[model samples]
Target: MTLDYRWLHDTVRDRFDSDDAMEAFLPRPLTPDELKQQGDDRYLSAMSQRVFRAGMKHSVVDAKWPAFEEAFWGFDPEKLVLLSPEQIDGYMNNDRIIRHRTKLQTIPRNAQFILDIRQEQGTSFGEFIANWPSADIIGLWNLLSKRGARLGGRSAAGFLRLVGKDTFLLTSDVVARLMAAGVIDQTPASQRDRQRVQDAFNALQRVSARPLCQLSAMISLSINPRGGLKFQTQRY
Candidate 1:
């Protein structure tokens, strides 16, 4: 009972008035070289931003990113990994940034995680991100959760999406469409359920020759019909 890829593409195209308009909305995954060129600072910043954005308004976090950049010393992986507990605790009192101590604590820990990747891979964290196969992106999400602090589930997927990695997001709308297509009985949390969802996306990607990001977006359009993502209150 998988949704037809052609049908999903057609439905999404029909939503827009013209072909060009629809084309503009389609997401394209970055190439390995392009992704690798982003450097560690950018990857660190993107990861930190996505972490802070969890369970909070994106615009509010985005508006304060400049202060974040300054406070975190431009998110340099080498610099952030050395951040002391006293410095991290000071952020709790800093009014310019989000004051959630738990979330604030993740920055240096995750920064060290990024540095570990560089030490092991002999390349920037961006290269590590770029090398992950899109077809098995769920595995990467699992790795992130296991290796990096506060990088499980939505945070991992959201970070990948933010960095233009070719991965599908399991947003509520996408999960609803998966249920309707008989891909899953409920929101995928367990490894078995998440693997099923990944397999479904892989099948669709094979049929359409599109990245998972595009397939995910098209599926959302097919189900929701109306455009724009409405944030759900619950963490998925």
Candidate 2:
């Protein structure tokens, strides 16, 4: 089915009180050059942050991230991969961080994931992300979900967004907009639905020439000023 970009644009534009307001609501994603320049350690840090961020307040997680960086040796994959299980379990005694043992355990595992990618691709994690085709971004999400610890579903997408990847968010409002546009019948909780959502974004991009980040925010705003978040029980 063909999407109505005109309707989407007009609806979003109508929702906002002014041009400045509309622009402020849009997301500013990192350029390819900027995305590639970020260090692998930062990616690891972001991945960990995104994991802990689930079912918790982002502000609390963000507030303690500096301690996490210091605690995890600046999130260097090599250093983290070397952490012994006892050392991982020992984080429970530390008050500087969240102190959740289950979540903390993912650090080493995800570090190994990062290392494997580095060794396999022979590039910084940022370069790997930057080089990924945004048109097939769902594939990237799937890969992250499969390889990284606790990086399933929105967590995978959240990590990508945290790192300024140019991909659309499947927020509640965005999904509603997509459904209304005949893009999908329901929340994109399956790979099949996700592919459809991706295809729709690609179609929208072809006409708008806007990055996925901005388009996603616009699509969400088209339906509502702000939408409630709903995490899926199953990974897409």
On TM-score, the candidate that comes out on top is 1
Global CA lDDT computed for model 2: 0.84
Candidate 1's TM-score? 0.93
- The lDDT, on a scale of 0 to 1, for candidate 1 is 0.84
How do all models score by TM-score? 0.93, 0.92
Count of clashing residue pairs in every prediction: 0, 0
Candidate 2 Cα errors over 4 Å, as ranges: 226-236
Which segments of candidate 1 are over 4 A away from where they belong? Answer: 227-236
Give the 10-residue window scoring lowest on summed lDDT in candidate 2: 227-236
For candidate 1, write residues 56-166 as lDDT tens digits.
888899899999999888988888888888987888889998888888888889889998999999988988999989889999999989998898878889888888888
lDDT of each: 0.84, 0.84
Give the per-residue lDDT digits (tens) of candidate 2, residues 1-236. Answer: 64677887887788667878767667777988999899888899999999999999888998999998888889989888898989977888889999988899899899899889989999887889999999999999999999999999788889998888887778887888788878898898998999998998899899989888888877766776543333221111
